[model samples]
Target: MRVQLFSDIASGAYAQKLLEIGEGLLGTDQDGMIPFTQQFCHAVESEDELIEKVFPNMQQNIVDENWLCERTILAPKNETITKIYKKILAEINTETSVYNSIDTVMSSDDTTNYPVEFLNSLELSGVPSHKLELKVGEPVLLMRNLDAPRLCNGTRLRVTELGRHIVKATILTGEAKGDNVIIPRIPIIPNNLPFNFKRLQFPLKVAFSMTINKSQGQTLKVAGIHLGTPCFSHGSNHSAKECRTPVRCSICKRTHHSLLHPKDANSSEENKTECVVNSSEAGKKQQQVLLATALVKTICRNGNEYSIRALLDQGSQASFVTESTVQYLGLKKTGFTSQIAGLGGN
Candidate 1:
């Protein structure tokens, strides 16, 4: 069997426009159709515009400026993405404003405890420390699967009450809607690590904005994406049933790879070539083709493990299995389906 190993294809506005029409046909066949959701993202800009400008536009208008700000959750792909969030927070936390951290307390379950140094070396599965910033009415995303049906990972919530010890929140969207629940620090073990590390922290994180990689397997009614560079991954910018209108940077009119676009492309090209004699930069480099295979173990819901042939693709954000493999393993379905598109158009 010839299987494509973690390949990627690019798409522009034209390809996406056709996809919207195709999904529209499918929606028309279904009587109860949900309206298409609009999402925005920039391919080469930090999330500062998203946090400072785009988010505020979506907030509900309040008469009192002194009142608590609208609730929001912020999500980053990694620690590196959090720099922008921290920067925005620093500016807001002036002499006239205040911010605080809700620290998590770690306690051992049994009377016999491990040494402080040994325990200190352990790192949690999610957030490292228990420290969190809380703002009343802000939205939050559950980071771990606590209750699969009611409060699973990716569940949305709104903060109602906060403290140094615990948080009181109300479920915003799910079967547990309107349900008030107290969030506490919980112990977790990191996966695929040599050491049996364990730590306690709240199984939650911000969600107002998240990386495109993390957004996979999710359906968004409204989304704002901040693109810092061209997405080199498959399906990074594709979505179903929604028309995308490129919002060019007000400062730079061009879209592709731009922090700022030149006023005239033709003019800039001439000037760029002129500077080539003075700037002795090396020529462009070639990309190497990478291929690797492995025999990997897959565990099913019933706990049956199978060793199967798999591709070792570091670039892929998710793993995929064939329909036949799923049937052979008798894996149970979660009943959730996502439509994935590529250059060949499906």
Candidate 2:
């Protein structure tokens, strides 16, 4: 029997692709062997065929939730594997918790001094006094100025309730010995630092944005995207004014920037997942020879323009974008670019 399948446009096209493989399994001969024949394909080919081949249990997992019978993550009573796992976790903790200092000052009053440039505004953005402890930043450095040090990009800090005052440091430059003193609502201590610098070094959380195109080949549970309402798809298509940039809808635009990058696929953990919000239709394009969808995770943004392309794989090696589609879209090329492994480009 011969099966000719066209790519179906449905809400669950991806899931249906999986189901196709399940149906193909019924065609095995008595020997249970697939014919060893290969066909030349185009630039954007879905690997549903091979995907189905590798996942024989997918048939079982498709309907049976109990078969998922998960294994326990709990460490066995003295298993060497547990020790190794814990050791690695401790090592990582040690590495990440160890923050460095450009200079060390050992004064009788337990105070360290920093240059004027080492300071930046300590903006907890105004944490209410009652909930101050709820804030995550650990004031690692007692900067002499209000400005944050350029080098302290990843440092986390929490200021003490009082002593942050009296820690005098110069905030001015030139021949004048400026008598500017730094004042904080609180003194500071580092929590992540080990017992050695536990009172100083700090760690803080920071947020970053990535485009949908850069995330193509990746699988994230949830992602945050910034699809503005006036996307490339906005305005009326009936006007026929030659060309148009698609704009996103109200639902896609209002999502917070932090929610645009998804962290995982359809995993059980929902709370820790990442979220994706649509950015402008700047990423989508139609190609005759290649059918693609932006790898929501692999997309990246440097400045004005972001990169978007379908991962030409069903969880294979790489991500891709067509040169022809990009040119037609009239987007600026970023200075730094990398090649997608399977993307057919010069």
Task: Identify the candidate with maximal lDDT.
Answer: 1
Worst 10 residues of 2 by lDDT: 126-135
Per-residue error (Å), model 1, residue 205: 0.8
Off by over 4 Å in 1: 1-46, 57-76, 88-130, 217-219, 229-346
Model 1, span 1-346: residue lDDT tens? 1111111222233234333443454343366433443332333245565665535533442122222223332343455345544554444322221222233224444214555454554433344334555556555677765655667665667677776567788876666777898888776655555434455666666555444544433334334554454444656433433435474434434232122122323354443211112122356332222235566887866898888888754323246888888897887667678654321122
Question: How high is each candidate's TM-score?
Answer: 0.46, 0.16
lDDT of each: 0.48, 0.27
lDDT of 2 at 234: 44
Clash counts for all predictions:
9, 62
